[model samples]
Target: MSDYLIVGGGVIGMMMARELSTAGADVTLVDRRGCAEESSWAGGGIVSPLYPWRYKDPITALATWSQSSYVLLAQELLEETGYDPELRQKGMFMVSVEDADDARRWAAKHHRPLTTVDADFLYQKEPHLKENLGEALWMPEVASIRNPRLGRSLRQSLVGRDNVTVLEHQPLESLIIEGEQVKGIKTHKGEIRADKTIIAAGSWSGELVKPLGLNVPVEPVRGQMMIFKAPQGLVNRVVLMDGRYVIPRNDGRVLIGSTMEHTGFVKETTEDARASLYETAINIVPALADHPIEHHWAGLRPGSPEGVPFIGAVPGYENLYMNAGHFRNGLVLAPASTRLLADQLLGRTPIIDPAAYALSGRVTSG
Candidate 1:
């Protein structure tokens, strides 16, 4: 029996396995499909929440902690594995912010730098934008990672470890529960026993635990995005307006995203969503209309109450744990969330208060 069994090989599970395996624990990570091919690959890789002022304290705490660690973590991953998870400080422009006071309050409380800029500043920074773009909130410290590369680096690192095993294309059949103890998981191939089991199955987490009489309020929310093949330095930074965004990658590709639809595990990309995203992208930067639409895809974010994730022990099972339900911020929050779960499992002092992300506490707060 391994020391840990992680179901779902997305960012959360891979990070969890990486953490525990680094601590000299034997870990086996299984995924229904290819690891890191789900939401972890399809995200915009923004290291912060869509709007920092919109979320509560818990989300802020996790995001801040994870953001702070990403630079070093990316470096470590690159050194360990030869893949570079392009972590770039491209900053962010929040155009047409509704409540400046709330944003200022959140920034001041969190010690994040925020500046107000007029249309002149917007045009001067990014000349391709449409006219009368108006004022925006500039956060110069914001950064983003190329999450698909990050996923590859993480998978390589995990596979290289002597204490970790990764099984892809293996579907989890059910949890092996005896009384209140979850021994391990039953995959399509066979059952694997472990001292502890963790469910990091993203949107499928709710269904995985429901048979055990736990109604974990995690559901799939579909988000679609389109990419434009623009030249390098065309779009300078990440631009957010009206809950939609355009992210410029180091390579000439720019990302335009996304629509939040509670469509119940439907990962299909709709023409309506693609057309809407294109319209938004062109309006934000008219030059994008000249560029070719390279790719349009969709991902399922694990939606939870107020966009907070549950990252602790399961309610009824002593040997079972969870690190899912991160919604849209999974990539941004993965490092800190996995670290906290590892801290709890290994009896180390947690990086933050464990109660806020605990399953029972989340249920109560919800």
Candidate 2:
């Protein structure tokens, strides 16, 4: 009896349910674990990739559009749900001796506001920074949010509405496909009959669709991050040292991240990863060496081979849709992806061409 059933209760699933329900669709969201218990919970809440110019145009455009909507989206949700999804716009600074040219080229390509500063200038901007530094690139729009809070607010906003329902700890066994059309979903309880279904199951999306003889080219990319509860003024803005970046929260805790490993579903935090994060954080701000490390965690990103998300309809199963494989940029693009998927599912025009994000297209290109 549900018009739409989202098969994951993370940011994507909950946001999509909110969008669809606002468009007057009956919606239910299900998650095997607690809501926002995956990448959405573990993410740094960064609104852009470390270097975004390396990706395709559509990906960049979609992310940009989504990033722009983040402020208003958070405001609206906060107003509706009485929850503050702390979206903070602290700037980003990248310091490096090598990869200078690559950083310059990428920053220019992305139209990021970049400023080249010297050792004295860098120290002046961040007094706690290590003086033994080279040139740095400053990007003003690279912002962050409290992702866990955002996910909770979104779920609350959707669930408070009449047309939305959220089912935590409920897992779908398989999709109910009949002659290339999805009529419902098969789960432990029973068959959930719905007019439309969207698979946004994050890393588990690939395994879930196997019984339906459908494959969405999404793989798990493990990212490990470390948190530092340091002095508030130790670092201003986000800092990118080496391939790793540092994000400072308003609560005097600096988030140091991340390690991109191909290890599948190994969620434990390793000593090497922690050390790597600590060394990088100290390199940016020498004073951070004195602070105690607060947290260390890892999450699985639903990555595609091409690094673009599977955002459109299935080849033979059009009624069954997909919105998975966002990988690291899921937090940045969540709003836009929700709108795009809603547009597609509700027969409205999408913000971008569906062909670019089509699951069938990615499979064929691969």
Candidate 3:
């Protein structure tokens, strides 16, 4: 039997597998697709919370802790896999449409740096910005990573380890519960028994734990993003205006996103969505209108009601654990999530109180 059977091979799943293997556990990761191809690949890969002050203290705290932890995780992944999950501190520029003061107040309450800048200054910094904007707030510590590369690197780094295995295109069917613990999972091919099992299946975590009567409420929130090969000096920091945002990359590819639509398992890219995103991109950074559309894609984020992730064991099941439900934050959260789950599995002091994030209970308010 494998020491641990991880149901998903996304960022959290792969990271947990890496951690388990490093701790001397034989781990096997099974996924319907390759690692990171799920929401992990499709995300904008920003490391900061959307609006930290909008959520509870624990949510912000966990997000903050996770953000700091990823700095080192990126370096380690680069060394181990030779694929860099390009994490850079470009900071974020949040422009106010009409609520500049409200955004600033929220930023202050959350303890995030809020640099108050005028419209002309904003125009000078990013000349392409729409002149109709009101004010701007800057958060310097906010960072981002190349998300697809992170998933690729995780797969590369873990595939060579003797203690771990990654099986792709093998969609999980059901769980095998034998009394007190999970025996294994029944995949399309055959049964693979595991000493212990953890369901880290992004949005699908809910369905996997259902046989054991464990409930992990989750759904997919799809976001469409468009990438453009920027002409010259254009937008730099991540810009959040109205309901839209812009993310820049190391390569000339500046990503303009996104539209939050709740379409169950519909991963198809749409032209209407692309047109909307392209229009929004030009609105945010007018120069983007000049650049040809390099690429456009859509990604599904495993959103929870509370906007916080579920990262602990099932309430009744002793051996079956869960480490999923990290919606838009998965890319920023890979390292911290892995470390905490490792500590929990290895029987060590946890980085935070695991009860808060336990897979059981009504944490929808979390």
Candidate that scores best on TM-score:
1
Lowest summed lDDT across 10 adjacent residues in model 3 is found at 357-366
Looking at model 1, residue 327 earns an lDDT score of 94
lDDT of each: 0.92, 0.81, 0.80
Tens-digit lDDT string for candidate 1 (276-360): 9999999889999899999999999999999889999998688999999999999999999999999999999999998888898
In candidate 3 the C-alpha lDDT for residue 261 amounts to 88
Which pairs of residues collide in model 1?
A: none
For lDDT, candidate 2 versus 3, the one ahead is 2
Q: What's the C-alpha lDDT at position 72 in model 2? A: 92
- Taking the tens digit of each residue's C-alpha lDDT, what string does model 3 give over 1-366? 898999999989998999899889999999988888878888888887676556666576677778887788889989988899888787877876466676678767767676777788777767778778866777788888888998898899999899998899899888887787788888889998898888888888877766665556778888888889885457667888777888888876788878888998788899899889988888878877788898888888888867778887777668888887777777666677777888998999988776667765653221
Worst 10 residues of 2 by lDDT: 357-366
Candidate 3 ranges with C-alpha deviation above 4 Å: 97-111, 363-366
Across residues 238-287, which tens digit of lDDT does each residue of candidate 2 receive?
77777787787778788888889888878888899888878888887778
Per-residue lDDT of 118 in model 1 = 89
Best by lDDT: 1
Question: Comparing 1 and 3 by lDDT, which wins?
Answer: 1
Q: What is the lDDT of residue 65 in candidate 2?
A: 86
